[model samples]
Target: MSHFDIFIGEVTGTALLILLGGGVVAGVVLKRSKAHNAGWVAISLGWGFAVMVGAYLSSGVSGAHLNPAVTLGLAIEGGTKWSDVPLYIGSQMLGAMIGALLVWVVYMGQFKAHLTDPEILAAQPEKEGLVDQKAAPAAGPVLGVFSTGPEVRNALQNALTEIVATFVLVISILTQGLNNEGDGLGPLGVLITAFLVVGIGLSLGGPTGYAINPARDLGPRIVHALLPLPNKGGSDWGYAWIPVVAPLIGGALAGGYYNWVFA
Candidate 1:
């Protein structure tokens, strides 16, 4: 595929990724929504499907590394050219940002309505009671927005989880692609990979939400911070570092391991 074709594919893939993944979060987290409280299983599987669609659409052109971690891992695996890695990652991140921005806009009305509702405020008795006594201030509206920052926890464990998840994803992709090299497994390979991704999310995503893609986590996290909302909280910059750093580490490690294992 030409560079332009690859670029278009990358952007489209990333946008689809954020639309599906972030959309699920908005569904579950937003108050009175249809998907609210559906929990992680729904989110994980939803993302898996998103990845499947994105990959199938773009894989022919750009190889569909919608995540920076995936792109970096592929470069290390020798499937991607080193010279193209930077551009691929940049496009992926931009695409992710665009996707997230769209989600923010789509949900803005709901968010605003929720924030201004007096009933919503009255419903939270613990918070309302504290505020009435002036012992605690009413929390800001941004509190409802989803975030990517890590909570206080073991940094090593968080990093380890990212590494393991990415490892599984990258390794599976490489192996499957290799197995189907001659037969041109095409879209079916993407579907199978998506299933693996969902499995990883369900089994191992508890710790850090399985942010195997750095762009997937950071891009949306950045959107949550930048978008105007009634009462947003801190972007959790301290914890944000973990997802960014860990996924790269995991991807690189997986790439290196793939090299060693197959060499």
Candidate 2:
């Protein structure tokens, strides 16, 4: 595919990915929404369907490596060119931000309702100058809808969780040939990968919300910080690097493992 196609495909597919995935979280978390408190199972299934739809939509064009980690793994595995890595990642990030913005737009009323609720606002800590970021809790009222935070605030544990979860994800993609060359996922591959994401969420999502995709996490987090919401709390900038860097590490490792062991 041409560079222009790659850019368009990644941007559009990834936007849809974050739109549906983040939308699920908003539905479950926000008050006045019908799906509020629908819980983790809904979230897991929603994300899986999000990936399936996004991949299927863009597979023919950009191979639907919507996650930077997936793109990195494909490049390391020789399916994608290293020279194109920046474009792929850049487009994914842009798409993710756009998707996140769309989520906020979709849930604007819910966000206003949730944030302005006196009871909800009362539960949030004062956001004057929270110096100890690492020791901070994982979520604010609506922060969970935008980005992930750990149930436990240990850096090492959080990083390891993201790395391992992402490792399982990328390795599966590599082994299954989900993003092979310009093929991305066939119908079967899309289904398998989508279900695999749900499986990972069910099994390993408790600790750190299973941020296996860098763009999925970081792009929305950036949007969270920028969007004008009342009592939105801090963006947890200190914990943000793990979701971005660890997944890249996981993807690189998965690619190396495939080259050495699975190949």
Per-candidate local distance difference test: 0.73, 0.89
- Model 1 residue 237 lDDT score: 61
Candidate 2 runs further than 4 Å off: 126-134, 137-139, 178-180
Model 2 per-residue lDDT at 162:
91
Predicted structure with the largest TM-score when compared to the true one: 2
For model 2, how does the per-residue alpha-carbon lDDT over 1-263 read when each residue is reduced to its tens digit? 88999999999999999999999999999987999999999999999999999999998899989999999998989889999999999999999999999999999999999999997776666532252444464456688888998777788998889989999999998887654456777788888999999999999999999989999999999999999998787788888999999899999999999999977
C-alpha RMSD of each candidate structure in angstroms: 4.7, 2.4
Quote each prediction's TM-score.
0.85, 0.94
At residue 19, what lDDT does model 1 achieve? 82
Model 1 C-alpha lDDT per residue in residues 1-263, reported as the tens digit of each score: 56786688888988888888778877877775677789989888988988988888788778788877777777787877787787888888888888888877878877776756777656555544543333123223333234443322567887888888888888777666633111212777888988988999899888777888878877777777777775553565656777788888888877788888974
Off by over 4 Å in 1: 116-152, 178-185
In model 1, which residue pairs have backbone atoms overlapping below 3 Å? 140-231, 141-231, 142-231, 142-232
Weakest 10 consecutive residues of candidate 2 by summed lDDT: 126-135
